[model samples]
Target: MSGRKAELVEQVARIRDLDLRLLDRVSREALTLDRNWMVEYARWQSGNWQTMSLYNDSGDPSDVAIRDCEARETTVLEHMPATRELLRSFGLKYMWVRIARLPANTFLWEHSDYRDLADLERHRLHIPLHTNRSATLTLGGARVHLGYGSLWRLVPTNRHGACNLSGPDRLHIIMDCYADDTFRDLTSNLTLDDNDIQWLPEATDGEISAHLDEAVALGKLGYHQAAEHSLLKLFYQYSMPEGMGYDLVIRAYEMMGEHARAEQWRLEKKVKLCLA
Candidate 1:
């Protein structure tokens, strides 16, 4: 067995916390950035998830077309000296870098990334600047709070999602890089503590039925979007069979006599979740 597999069991786990730490200066500089520069980008996100690009192909802060490119620092990074210094210290081949913000009651729906990128050895890293206990990521049957001070490695190919359940927006510097010796060395000390993980409890049949009924009620009241969001949020709230949230949405639509909408969601489920 390889060294990483011997330590982690799975070579490509959903998320891992590295022993590496980000400089306090960098975190402070990141927090000093004005929020007005942030632009809302609609990707797989379901709610108020915004981003300000630091590095990309076009140098446009709003142009968030993530792909393998010779990324250059955008004008937005020009004012963030500490952040720029930190990135230079890493010396890794970066594909894209951005400052991501997830406000209260926001969510990034369960989905894998990098599906459209060319097949290569790439990884995603996150450094939290401002966050709260309510900000968490869920994947592989567990929820994680990507706490401050540590650099986190996330395998974007795994089906995962994130949410900030309540007040106080969350901020993190997100980096996508191609694997190299420096990148390997940075993750060599990857470790996770039991306290960092919150295993989700499986939803009971009764609970599932109750949730479905609530969604149906909202749908009948002309709050179809809210109803759909309620069902989709189940993935973060409970550990059930894979794709159960999407199934609940389809079932709720069917119960409301919206067969066309139900079928549309069925196709959406396949595409969004990348179901085979």
Candidate 2:
């Protein structure tokens, strides 16, 4: 990592933990509201996952689409006084804010956001309201178990995903804020120690083969999209070389006798990775 990038990682890792009681309060407040969860299918996410917007540029509660960072207005904050107060305490310029929920035994496929031209320079912060040991955020080959009552800065530029494996519903209040002097001040003193990092193990050949087999079976059942998603998910499940998951997708398409489609994915992979 470059010096600046390494500094950011350390700063984010050193973010001060929030109070547990405040997190519990926010959780209770969130639970009291009627659920208005929506999924971003275009992102190729899977399982029972959804998000509720609390703040956005439109100030429309129903608008949960993640968009370019901008000055935002509160949507559901009137109903979530505690949450509003909590955010106000930070005194940072906020952009989009939302509560994301991932039910038990669900997985969010690996993906990156804020990579497009429309995306503005900003940082994503997370406050875990409800989570268990099994809920993990995987990024840069490290699996992070962010405990409750703690604030974490997610690296939006990196390939990352989340999973709630055999756990209760996992919920997080995510806030997008523009980087500014105040942001720098808040993170300047924070430093992530070595113990804070946990590296993921490389997948065994048997494990990779078994997953590919499952993907193939899904394709045979005529669920081509599911099969593709299954193959794409391997990027998160294993410590494979860059673009290996994309290569597997092409292979899966070929296995299904879709030569044309395989070639299409081969090109798409390049575009997706900006290699084209």
The best candidate in terms of lDDT: 1
Number of the top-ranking candidate, with TM-score as the measure: 1
lDDT of 1: 0.80
Over 80-153, each residue of candidate 1 has an lDDT whose tens digit, in order, gives 77788888878988999988889899888887778677889998988887899888888777778888777788
Q: Candidate 2 regions off by >4 Å?
A: 1-14, 117-119, 191-198, 223-226, 263-276
Q: What is the TM-score of each predicted model, taking all chains together? A: 0.89, 0.84
State the lDDT of candidate 2 residue by residue for 220-243, as single tens digits. 898988888777766656666666
